[model samples]
Target: MMKLDFDDWNIHVGAPHPFNARAVPKIDNGTERPDPRRYHDPDFMREEWDKVFARSWLLAGPASDIPEAGDFFTFTIGPESFIVVRGEDGVIRAHYNVCPHRGSRLVTADFGSMDRFTCPFHSWKFDLEGRNLAVTDEETFRPEVLCHGHDLTSVRCEVAVGLVFICMDTDVAPLSQWLAPILPQLELYDIDKMYVVQHRRSDWGANWKGGVDAFAETYHLHAVHPQTQGLMDDRTQIDLWPGGLSRQFVPFAQPASRYPDQETVNPGIQSMLSDAGVDPNEYRGTAAEARHTVQQAKRRRSDELGLGYDRFSDSQLSDSVVYSLFPNVQIGCHPEAIFLHRFLPHADDPNQFTYDTCILYRHVDAPGYRAPAWMGLAEGTDMSGGTRPEVVHTPLGAPPGLGEVLDQDSDLLPIVQAGARSRGFRGPLWSEQEGRLRHFHAELDRRMTAP
Candidate 1:
């Protein structure tokens, strides 16, 4: 039997708050768009980078990425390169990946295990604890220069529900305070125990917010994502929290017809299904049996995480949950696997953003569970060097490549970027269904305008 923290889990309801809260400046949907100036002006972007990005809690990484002492991973947070390292003492910490001496970058590689960070420029050495231990010229430099206070600048970092988050602000409230309401639900993923199986990166000509907004709603799935339209229908629903976090539920079931021959075995679902250890044979026969078997398997996994024991009781489990942790990180939790996408801004222009996709699932069983068709659909090929991955280009005509069908929703981004600047285009048609978007922009506006 798997042991888990049951008290940390709770029911996930997509209901609006019952009581009225603090007053937020409301946007007028009747006339004028959200200022186009906000997207293009360097001053505006800088202000946001300082007020919004600087003082907020951004998802940095998960503990699983650095399971053992001395393990570390490097990433970018608002033009700043951050390194999350598990020290020799088994404590995980975040630091600005810059050398204090001559301002050289420390640790240029993506990730690895190291006892100390040595600056390539001047050979300045520091331990995994981030302390300035050795200096090149001991005679010339005063003792104060080697003091602990003069060591690497550290950021406030914390782990909750298996997800790692870092704050640039030193005086920010405890992460648990800001993430309390949703922490219980997030614990269901057992993310702390998960590891990254793949990492992908690409650049796009769109705003960072646009990249985030892309995954905010599924109302466009049918029309925008035609290939997977049937996979994600209207029954899907989304629930949003105050801190730029949201959970989307979409129903999915094991298809009996898809793997007819493998009646006694589970069809390969890449790393995802294999991790859950679903019995391939048990999920055969009628649609009811397939659904029942899949649900039972999910219950087994959830039970291991100490979450949602009653979730499988529902017959039609038609929803997949997509969780977005403010500003940039989005987690697509499919039953078979987990996908993470992060949007990083490259320039002052909100029209340009970097898109990264990382998929993590258990490796397929060794003597082998391989299904060509199933694998093809799950693993998107690398066509980055050729045409853009997936973008909606109506006026540009259909995608001329053959990797994967680029849909409208993906294409709609550049248009929104262009429209945001046009006198004709302004604010969006903000609705209750688009509550997450509304909440996101509202919090952004508040932070950007804070004194």
Candidate 2:
């Protein structure tokens, strides 16, 4: 009962989709091969820190992480660390994690609640607003030394669409303006109403950009994650926007075109149907109908539970609308929840980076309401915002403890990094599906080569 043509599987160009209706001009980043050195050269990495990381608005963490006054979390990028805290006045602010005197790092814990930040090294104290409270035997110091402000140096911090972003360069555009290209689309999810259900950070044996390139597209999914072929369509519709923003709309609950038997309702499709409150035994349609079936079932379930699915389009309900934010963040948007992935660079090693993952869920009280099974949240995850979970840190080469798809990525990226280092290899020749990678590198190249 559904069209099986692979070429026609994607959303029609200039179609009437909700996200596409916005006035995002499509950008055609030329087909230039990216330099391999950008991934592993230490000099290139240093330049990226100066040009891109320092000048751009980087996603720090969820605003939901600090819901109350004095609640704070630490986010480290390259050689610097920042303390993002909600002040008593209900304003969220970020300050350098280092103490002004003698440069000892403050707030070693990942997250906590405190009226004042006390430096463990010398007992120097600072208020939640980053105002220096105590000087630790200040009378011994000269007036000129003390005259210099002891207050913690503040970083430009702003919140948009429920995420906190910090910019080291004070002169850069405001967060709203920088994200103007995709902000409206992001707002439709009501991300501020969601809460972090799972958080994990692990060191990976790849450059931060390597991780970014891996996630920018799904061209490798059929080859690397064959298990997903049964449930996810690899023929993704790529949309490129300005400011290095791009998204791929991949239909779910349907078999990939490469699958030999597209007529059968496979196990993956059955599981998705069950998650959507549909009985697989009663699903009398072919595999292509599975996506629509789940979408309608989810709609019915939402209406019965007052879950408010009217605002979302049918594609948004049953497809993986994954967005790749420039530099190092990728977001997977859905009605029930959202996935946030951050690839953070290592301070000293060009061959290593940290992969941070957070799963945010919009809480609903109905017994039948739940996140899609494809989200792969761990068993016993706390959906309620009752208690925030501590971040789980996994060492390099150890199991990331993320889902199966991500674990496969973790294992494969290092090999890709190693391959990039080989003398025989020249550079990556991207295909049409890899437009996001080209767009991202173009932005990076633009920054690196700027006057």
Candidate 3:
């Protein structure tokens, strides 16, 4: 019996690779067990809203979602709703969604195009830049009541690497500083050129932090998402940076170390090869080498198709480089496409949160260019950016249509939430594999316990 090359489950264990070496440092996040109460306690949730969400630069949506002037969308966090719109000046701005007159919500739709926002109740209109355009019966109101100027309250809005971000704390650091660690790597994909092909939001019965924890680590993949074992490597390369940011590089187009057969090219690997324009039957390497082979093939195919893959390293071409943006967003970066997942806290309930998933793909005229098979985009998805799909809202118990792995997470997370409330459950005993979770909770503790 021959010992396998990956039998020890240790890969990328020594020095930091050139790709992520810049962000990796010897910052020690103490290994204290995280309190389970933070997941279900209402008071803790409230504290997070005040300290964490309120102060952090949150991902609003992809900038590609609103390309033209007057294009707008809404993002709600806790009790506040924001209108993120592209002004006529081609600047992206965020405004409080309330009408100044009576606090009526100016826009109810998830996305729309409008020259100005008009309140349905009092018919107060505001321009795309959120300036007051018209106030119905303006003479009736006293000047003192309108002394503050009836403009929609604006927040700090910034665009970086093709994503829109808004921060309520005006004094907070610039978005670039907040995203400094991962910005350079994110730029390699040219995500700004990509367009959203699918977007969906679903209500889940779990605290927002709990939802973040679930997606932040792959430690639970063996138990919760067994189906992915054949396609994903559980031995992930975890990298931590300052500001609660972390990422895991999970090898794709390969089987986990625990898989019984390492030599066979499974269907998942075959699909990956086929998507990269490689013929599975012609593949002669072992399952582990499929990733590298696909990387080479993708580079060759990309050059033939005139697609951009030169900036990306070979590993990035075949692995899942998922980055967890502090507080709420997880981005899975790829050369051909990217996956954006946001876990938004429910306004009133600590035990409820909204899970938003958006799949973006760069359009290429070459028929050979295909997004990763793992993206699981449904048939007839509009990759051309001609049509922005309406946001689909799935109820708490219904299917989120987020494909196999995430839908499995949707089903399992609420159960985990329920277990967290049990008297016997003390706290999570995180392993080295779950360092990202520990890193996130450490940052959460730092913010929540700050003076």
Candidate 4:
């Protein structure tokens, strides 16, 4: 085992490594020079999926998702199918889904439970702990040969905020060291205490990066999310971490037209408003109706956690932080839930990508509630044929259903894919606000070119 340390963070490995490389200095400023061809290059994508996607900290199904022993779920990363199961010992383990004896996939379905898993191909039996039990023709096989190094190769699995994360590389670091800067903030949301409220997946025609990059910044909120503009003030502050990740903080929004004085507004909303650059004197000077509305929205958000996004400022909620973790995974935090979005390459075509969105909330209200009706999937922009809605967040207007928002976002992907390769269009121009996206590319370049 080789332990790698990056600053105060620990990359947990068994023993210490001989040497180390500190992360390259942060990019303070640079002109936007994004290459569009990277989004359409098959060679580029293949390498990306191999080097980045395979080894990275990927979200496994939620812990609550497989609360009982023998519970299991199948998920894919890069070209490998991985299975997560809870052992009889009550410990969760993740292993490559392929059978150790043959290449047959171990678990085919989404998620279920059993005391043992029998490979349908050759009837190879494995216990829930991933230990090989018996083979069909055991007498014919040499016992020494049979016992020689046969066991399900387990990957490193850990839990944080109730979300299960697996790393294909056994030498990779622990989740805590990698997630140091934001761990405190994440715990504040008590993600581990939450369970799945709903989950959905969509396939985007554009490159994986296109779909994920779209969610990195709120700079587009004003133009792309007109409905949410009034609720979200453009002046929300963005705080970037040393590692290139960042969080957008939106203090609560109180429309001047609604509130008459700062005293009338809820204390929480008033604090949020002040954080957003509103002066107490100015808040007091606001109209009576506006003040009343601000107070009302504040109470609604406080009481419901995050359900009333339409009523409160998107930035006001402390749990509303999102992280653009280096390459493919994006974690969006809400008071009541945690959503994970992963962009996976479909094939050699960089324009084609597999998008998986998983929303996990807690089972606080009910111990054993079925997944939301929206779980399997709504309509997406693909061969799937089902039509999901595009949800819009508006300040003054009504918010669309979640399905509608997902649908709208899915439709734009293919168009972007086409434009990336079109003769008329040029490459994307990354902006200063897109530090994470830029940092992502810089890291990609660094890893690809590393010795």
Candidate 5:
């Protein structure tokens, strides 16, 4: 018999980050169940934005999305708008979206290449470096205010793991410092080189935190995504880190303990074997043997296809790692793809929020490669679709092709939002699995009052 270690690949695994030295925090204090008003109260939403969203390093967009100079995207959080663009020097920067002359928006489109940005209202112009180049009537205004470098108010911006992160607080720490604990896991996969195969955004009637609560735990999967019960281990192992970061290492291709008759091959195991290039119908082993078999099969398959995943251990080949960034981002990292979902507070409505999801892949040319169906991909469908990516926009509750598992969550989240108002409902009760949610709110509280 063996006590299998699910992590550590026996390769050049680096020492744990200094922040990971302590044990993960528990939900012991009165902080377990947060006050429900934080979800739908207008004042609370405003307070959170001022304290959390305004100061945190939020995921703006991917650097790969804006590769060439002049490539840019608009990220709107709360009432503020920012433009993330590649400067002439091939560096990425973010600037406030207001025109210096009349306070009108400078860039109007979601994304595009522009030689420079010109305000539509007064035609004030600025280059990609946010340098003021021209103004329709420069002589009309006082020279002091004019010479004050009205270009575009530059906001704090930096790049990490191919994603652009911007902070409204100019004095905020660098991205690396803000995200130290999770850096090792991010570098494990060379995500900066990956391509965005699918991008989606939807407006939901749930508060931003409410939306975060929904995706933060796997406890809901049994009731909401019943179809996945037999395929994944629902009882997950969670790890918490400093700077309000947490991770849940989810085991895949294994049946839940709830499933009886573990010795015989189940349909889920059979499907996993067949997808890994093993003939499940020809497999002479029991269901319990499927995980080991699939691991070896995928490793051999990766070598045969020339996929460059030398840094990944066999356990990482099929298991899923879900990471939660403070304020409002949840990511599911898999060997095949990175599932990133970002939630933002609705500008005016406390009960509404917007979610943006991006699924990035390595863009390998292997024909036998298959993205897991849980990714909402159909059989035989090319995940790349020629690798030229385009984000599909849908209102909340629409099927964004994220597979049946999350599709169920999409349909039920709105109702969950409405349920928050029921007088009969108390605040959330924390189980050990949902400790990440408590840690998230604890950080928010700390930041709200922390000098």
Candidate 6:
């Protein structure tokens, strides 16, 4: 299923590519101690708002979330808000969440469907295409004021590999230009057809950068989520890219170096095999063989089973090639499903942030079939069984807060935040393996300080 190159790509199936590139400057922002104020200073947070959050392109949600005309969802980050909507003509667009009339917030709920958005305060209406349809008191207001081009202030929106992204600022480069080097890598797993099966949002006690930092490197993996030791080799291999985007390749379905016996199948491998819809007992090979076995099985049966996993390579199927988009999105590109995380800053506090998690799987109606084991869903579970998928929200630091692995992170991040301000505490000294962290902060520093 893996092509030697992307030459034979059918845009409908594979992402067409000449793989345009944005140059990544050789820079290291990680050699020095990360300023502790980045986690808690109000002034630093303001700088981030004006420079980073306001200008960068952000992942609103999947295009599949609003599959029908007039369906829409609201994505709010920091103080900015936008609505990603599917138009009557089937085009996906994003509009600012403010009414042009009185500046009252237009869309209240997280998601809904409508022919037009009627301002609750003054009843000024706008169509799904963001056209200013009707004014409450048309006769009183002069035509000069009403026709002054106050259509729902459209935000810059673009779609790639199925995600709807919005840019708050008006002057940044196009999304494609920003996504240059990272786009082709993401194209490996066809994302346009995938549907979100699990959506979980949780507010964390740490800063947004802290949340992003935790997932960027695996150096903390053996310490924070010790139970996950053998699930994969967590010694992270950081792959730097242009525009602060990078990836960490962690070998999956294989035991970590610390595991006692690499010859036999570890408990982690057995659990993974069972979760992947493969019977570990039925596997007649060693633990090293389990990963390839699942990869080959998934590739061979993808079309027959209706799960479109044939696009991924054996390495992609078993290992975690987590592609991190600049600023706040972390995309875990897997063979069967894609794991995503969006870290949002708090409206007022730099010390607090929210972590939004979504797991998207290839949608199929086949019975007795299972998606990737990462979601902890029952083996052979049909996520498409329901009319629509439901997003489950849970408070962090609670039982079943996005499952066990995340629960550990949830508990630890808050403590890390508390320690950040300790009188004796010094700044963090990252190891070479966490060079991705240095690369990210380097880009962030450039962006924040750039004119």
Q: TM-score, each model?
A: 0.73, 0.96, 0.95, 0.72, 0.89, 0.88
Task: Report the C-alpha lDDT of model 5 over 213-264, residue by residue, as the tens digit.
Answer: 8888877777787766677766666667667788776667777656675677
lDDT of 6 by residue, 1-451 (tens): 8735321210111123122121246344546776777778899999988999888999999888899999999898898788889999999999999998889899978779998999999999999888888888789988898777778999889998899999878899999888887787787677777787777788888899888889888778778888777667765445576788886767778766676656687777887777566778887787666777766766656767755565455566667778888899999987557888999999989888888888777655555355665656534444672444556666645554577888788888889999987866676787676777787787888888898
- Candidates in order have lDDT scores of 0.59, 0.87, 0.86, 0.59, 0.76, 0.77
Better of 3 and 5 by lDDT: 3
Model 5 CA deviation exceeding 4 Å by range: 1-31, 261-268, 305-310, 378-387, 396-402
Q: lDDT per residue, candidate 3, 1-451, as tens digits?
A: 9934431453562223468453446556876987889988888888889999999999999998899999999998889999999998999999999998889999999899988999999899999888898888989989998887899999999999999999999888999998888899899889999999888889999988889888888778888888888878888777788999988888899888787778888899999999888999998999877888888988898788776677677778888899999989999998889999999999979899999999999888776687887788888787788999988899988888888888888898899899999998988988777788899999999998888
Per residue, candidate 2 scores C-alpha lDDT tens digits across 1-451 of: 9934433544442236666453346576776777889988999999889999998999999999999999999999899999999999999999999999889999889999999999989999999888889988989989899788889999999999999999999998898987887888889898999999989999999999989998888789888999988888877787777777888887899888778778889889998898888889998999878998888998898789877787777878788788888789999999888999999999989999999999999988877678888788889888897878889999998999888999999999999999989987788898777777898999999999987
Model 4: lowest-lDDT 10 consecutive positions: 12-21
Which 10-residue span in candidate 2 carries the lowest summed lDDT? 6-15
Q: TM-score ranking from best to worst?
A: 2, 3, 5, 6, 1, 4
* Angstrom error at residue 89, model 4: 1.8
lDDT of 4 by residue, 201-298 (tens): 55567788887777776556545554333333333334445433555443233322222333354444444444333444566533223333444444
Better of 5 and 6 by lDDT: 6
Cα deviation at 366, candidate 6, in Å, is 4.7
Among these predicted structures, which one has the highest lDDT? 2
Off by over 4 Å in 3: 1-10, 13-17, 20-22
The whole-model C-alpha lDDT of candidate 6 against the native structure comes to 0.77
Estimate candidate 5's alpha-carbon lDDT, on a 0 to 1 scale: 0.76
- Name every residue pair that clashes in candidate 2: none
Clashes of 5: 2
